[model samples]
Target: MTAHERLHTRAWVLHPDIKSDEDRRAAKPALDEAVALAAALPDLEVIGANIVPLPRAQPGLLFGSGKIAELKQTFSENKIELVLVDGPVTPVQQRNLEREWKVKLLDRTGLILEIFSDRAATREGVLQVEMAALSYQRTRLVRAWTHLERQRGGLGFVGGPGETQIEADRRAIDTQLVRLRRQLDKVIKTRGLHRAARAKVPYPIVALVGYTNAGKSTLFNRLTGAEVMAKDMLFATLDPTMRRVQLPDGPEVILSDTVGFVSDLPTELVAAFRATLEEVLGADLIVHVRDISHPETAAQAAEVDSILSSLGVEQDRPQIEVWNKLDRLPEEERTALLARAERGAGVFAISALTGEGLELLLQEIAVQLRGARHEAQLHLKFEDGRKRAWLFDQDVVREETQTEDGFDLTVLWTARQAAQFAAL
Candidate 1:
């Protein structure tokens, strides 16, 4: 059977300690993200959902006997071949739950990993996802390798066949993991070299980052006029795409579209994608695109901020909040948002799909970039022709005068570039 044809599953939300109304309210976004993910699965059907409020002492199964019985009956009635949990599950707990329910059980991490595996297109992306999957699977090796014992007899074994098979699988995975890491390291080094070259040219890097489906790719295409894959689906763009964009002031900058951050993103995937995310760390500015019409905009913004902080991108870098999709909002609400944005709120209300208020946003970005530029007057010895040529290539020289023993040049550059020039 085809992959889509064989794909069938049911999903549910189970929060163990949503004690207060506030806690439940906070969990609603996670539940929404889970439901959205399940709906995105081509062959999956969400036939049942349950919010189990089990105590910590009995956290293993995440449900009481009564609740388990109810879930089993519902699964049987709905013909659910797999169970997708909205939270992480311990390896033992996952095995036990699958045995009791007589179906496959995948926790939140596994589900996200599966989606990433399916969405990965480029070789780099595939390698990163494979590394993450292996890392995650290593912790659940017992459950994963238990079935290796059923292999047919092929050779005389001094050790038990099952033990040998398990050891072999573990060793193979370890070897593969090492190879993948090496490949990724090479890719990262190549990227670093490219970044260094770009720095020499010194085009301001503006990275677009936000929650999934917040129109980041759409805005990226709109700004850069590059047709990247922009869809309503979750995690549409896995690989980072960069294009040169001319600002309103006629200054050019490199705009990058990064992978969208989601609530409760798998830690393994995050760790794996660090190389890709390094772009954010090196950015001159970050454009945080938010779906202003979405009810969870603030929370989504918080999640993005948390991820940025974790990636070490929170060190005094400028961030512009672009409240996008204003076309979806009512006129009065949109006006209110715009008014708030106008009051020096570090936010811009725009519609990436419709190009509404984009000119103003571009002008704002240009203003920030202009502010980031620093002009320096340096006296270079006349014999230092190479340094003069490098400075001309590094930045735009506004003025230059030949002196008796030296040449005085005035150059405009970003602070980082200024440091590099000073080092020279």
Candidate 2:
């Protein structure tokens, strides 16, 4: 059933501010983020949210007994059906808390995994989410469901009526994970082959990446005229979408809109990010989009930079900074931001909705990628089906002709792609 048909799930959000030595975000914003995450799902109706301050975590219940009782009263008063903790919750803690509060519960990682399961469209995406869900289930071993035998949607992380509880079932989870690994391996190999073949296209890939709800998809749709989802929702753009665009005054290039990055991602969902990082790592130019109007835009940008650093994208790599959502800013601030953008090299303030400052951004892109690829023509024997297929897979063949002894084709490709094709 669709989310709209069912009664909305009343939920509460909490951010645990445990005592920490270093590197902790402000509790209030973290609570706000947790609430927003809950709001992302159509079926979730978040009625209450707060930052729960703790000196240290409890081994059994995650919260102190007093605090748990107090929160239980609050949950009962608010009729909270689900409790979303914006941090890790051990299996014991989860089970205890659920019973104590008489409500369903999802830790930070589990909630994100559920979101991924709901949104994953591609085969590889679905498999990755399922594998991550299984890995997550390995710890809980509670009533869990898997799609190992059926290629269906959802990982069944969300608990509801008629859930089963099969004790001592670690073996089932391990076996499912093995099968999922094999399936994912096959998908990845096929993906690798596609990427290798796609590299032959001389178009330098310009990738747009930023924090969720940063307007990357809006900008991508504006530039490419592709019908990519550009909602104001978090993680609205899940799959990496690529489109070819012919620049008005420059060579054609590939514009790729990748999955939006999230902050404080849990280790359990690391495999789910593989597809996103793969796209970013392969980009010739990275466009870091920022919602300049957001209060925590600086923190969001820092997280993006940190993730890129972890991906080994060097500091000297070609990049552009786009201060997006300028239309959402006040007139005075937008003007000031525009002025600042003009002063900074490779920075553009644009409102993708209104087409403000995009001309300059496009021109800058053209300048950056100028002379990056060349037009070439080649002739291959009829027996060279693999080479022909590889070239076609690259989407570089602009023209082709059948000849007496072979085939003639025209292509536009980068020198590196040409070398790889030659090696093939």
Candidate 3:
């Protein structure tokens, strides 16, 4: 490649700290995360990052005129080719900013869409990303460019200007959205079939969820012995991965590693990826993994919980909080965290990277999954040997007696185990 072509695009990340917003995060960590997000995309050299404090956002340009002038001067001096805003930017604001700065501009949603576009691996993931990107693009088609107004000729039989360039483009996007929806529906149907198949075999599903870069993938790898992409990078694991793991002295479970949640995740993405996130919805237990070493661990956990709630996870769903990354904490802090975990029900402190406290965590998982056990009797026909064998395999059967037409077995099991046996 030529030197010119090889040069990475110079980019600056700006996280707007809105002073008026009571829920606004601290500026420094937010800016750091925004910079990391920018760095996740290929071919972008993040030269600098800062927190742009605003008492109120300007509707036309996001930043006030003075701040815009100052930023323009900084961009020119730094030879920046792109400005990435780490918050929502209106289409008008985006256009105005790009024109004034004479460089490309991408908002938080746009940047995330680009990252998802690059990271998607599976067919469903790709389709989901495309649908989300199109949804985002549809909102930005508000004459951001003069070219969108340019008209093209249609069939001679048609009337005036056919449709405007913008109309044709939007219609094209709508058509593609429809096509993608059809393909995605098929994929979702296939996924449902797989879910049903798994239900028959019915190992309890344990889902791992957390904020981005919270070592969920690392923990998933350590627990399941699968080579999922685990990295100290945001959105490293996009596609949901499932593996069957047998707990020591306990029942086996299907462990699902899902996409990590982030604060202010794009609405389009949440909608498009609903089918994928269904894994979490169907989980028998939710493990909320946390990077306990991070400074904003509490805030991050809140964000994850908020997203889970938004996704319609019921309040009564069994959940365990895993305080991960203990190895990264200082000795005193680690000891304190461990002590705190001891006092907290359903909370465990561990380092996924070092396999610390995993044994206790596993035990807790098994205990939670066991639920409440009760004695019950099940009747099975001669042709239902498989069901009877499954009950035996689960070690839930207490006694059995053969009748002329069937076998009556008494079993002591939790409702979860009984449900699995029934599915068999």
Question: Best lDDT goes to which candidate?
Answer: 3
Q: Is candidate 1 or candidate 3 better by TM-score?
A: 3
Per-residue lDDT over 1-424 for candidate 1, one digit per residue giving the tens place of the 0 to 100 score: 5675456555554444445334334555666677666665656777665556654424466666787888888888877787887777888688778888888988888987887888777678899999999988877885654545556466745554467666777898899999998998887778777776776564788999999989999999998889898877778888888899989774688899998898877889888777677778778889999998988999888989999998977546888999999999988998898889898567888999999989998988888887566577889998898889887764356679999999998876677667666677
Deviating ranges (above 4 Å) for candidate 3: 1-7, 143-163, 371-424
Candidate 2 stretches greater than 4 Å from native: 1-6, 142-168, 374-424
**TM values, all candidates:** 0.81, 0.81, 0.83
Per-residue lDDT of model 3, residues 1-424, tens digit only: 4675458998999999999889787899888888888878878999888888899888789999999999999999998999999988988889889999999999999999998998888899999999999988987784454433354355655533423666889999999999999999898889877776665454778999999899999999999999998988899889999999998888888999999888878889888777778899878899999999889999999999888998889787889999999999989988999999999999999999999999999998988876435678778999997888788665566679999999998876657666667676
lDDT of 1 at 404: 95
Candidate 2 local lDDT, residue 233: 77
Model 1 alpha-carbon drift over 4 Å, by segment:
1-25, 48-50, 57-59, 142-162, 371-413, 416-424
lDDT of 2 by residue, 155-258 (tens): 75643332333333677788888998899889888987877666676678889999988999999999999999888878877788889989779889889998
Clashing pairs in 2: 202-413, 202-414
- A best-first ranking of the candidates according to their lDDT comes to 3, 2, 1
Instruction: Output the lDDT of residue 418, model 1.
Output: 73
267 in model 2: Cα distance from truth in Å?
A: 1.5
* 1 versus 2: better lDDT goes to: 2
